[model samples]
Target: MATLQIDADNFQPTITNNATVIVDFWAPWCAPCRGFAPTFEAAAEKNPGIVFAKVNTEEQQEIATAFNIRSIPTLMIFRDQIVIYSEAGALVPAAFDQLIEQAMALDMDQVRLEIAGQQASS
Candidate 1:
């Protein structure tokens, strides 16, 4: 469950297959990103079922633009092929654990029904 280095090429396939995917939007020069890297890696090891991936904003500008990442060290969580949570800044381990727990607690059936309702309304 090592964190996967993701770019535009691998992003779609990698995320779609996993039930839960946590993506870290980072850049090498950013101090907070560096600080968060270990936490991210440790979480990946701890949660073997989830896909933990990193997109380097510095090297993968297209991916960053597609996701509209305005800040360094943005974190996104995807579940059941949809983005469930996204936020900017570094997460302390406790917060990260809470995020994982939230993701785990999600009822994807309800989420998808809500998405369908939204799409129909739109």
Candidate 2:
């Protein structure tokens, strides 16, 4: 699967609708981000069920701000619209794979219930 480009406009709904979302916060000028791109892309290909989104901080300032992204190559994992994991820095392929496994291993039922609760209250 190719990495999906996400901007401020589509980001919210995309993450909200997906059962699992992995967002790569990156900038084109950052060397680490550029280097990590292939690894990220590989991960996306390995996991077809998950939604992998790439947010270019330079072009999508609002999306970057919403996530409080202070560094390039940050990875944020969202389950049912709530952030479950957020880390700053570029990850090697092995570490990135582990992170994805961790995200997948999480209790998704709890996440779904939490989202439901939030929706019920709103």
Candidate 3:
């Protein structure tokens, strides 16, 4: 269960299906990013239900800019086509697990409702 590789051209489609997708923004030259790759892969293997993906920042500058990625090894979890959790820097396995749990706990429907309510109030 290797994480899907995302690029500037296909990032939207990768995250648009309302599925839980974890996108790892990384660069080859970053030592921390390289060190976390195996951990990310193992997590992907453990969680087959989630869509784990990688975005090579060096190769996808536009995508990086769109996501405001300012650091290497940034992880962004998207649920229901919306960003649920995002963080910069490489994470240890335990931290990564916590991140996944947090992503899973997000209530997208309620978030949407809140946004709608805010709009109506405005």
| Pairs of residues clashing in candidate 1 | none
| lDDT by residue for model 1 (1-122), tens | 88999988899998888888999999999999999999999999999999999999999999999989999899999998799998999999988988899899999999999999999999
- Listed in order, each prediction's TM-score against the native is 0.97, 0.87, 0.90
| Comparing 1 and 3 on TM-score, the stronger one | 1
By TM-score, the best candidate is: 1
lDDT (Cα, tens digit) per residue for candidate 3, span 1-122: 78888886678888887489899999999999999999999899999999999999999999999989998889988888877678898888998998888778877889889878989999
- The CA lDDT of each predicted structure is 0.93, 0.90, 0.88
Alpha-carbon shift of residue 112 in model 2 (angstroms): 7.5
Give the root-mean-square deviation of each candidate in angstroms.
0.8, 3.2, 1.6
lDDT leaderboard ranking: 1, 2, 3
User: TM-score for model 1?
Assistant: 0.97
Candidate 3 whole-model C-alpha lDDT, 0 to 1: 0.88
Candidate 2 residue pairs in backbone clash: none
What is the overall TM-score of model 3 with all chains considered together?
A: 0.90
**TM-score of candidate 2 versus the correct structure, residues matched by position:** 0.87
Ranking according to TM-score, highest score first: 1, 3, 2
Model 2 Cα lDDT, one tens digit per residue, 16-96: 789889999999899999999999999999999999999999999988997788988899999767788999998999999
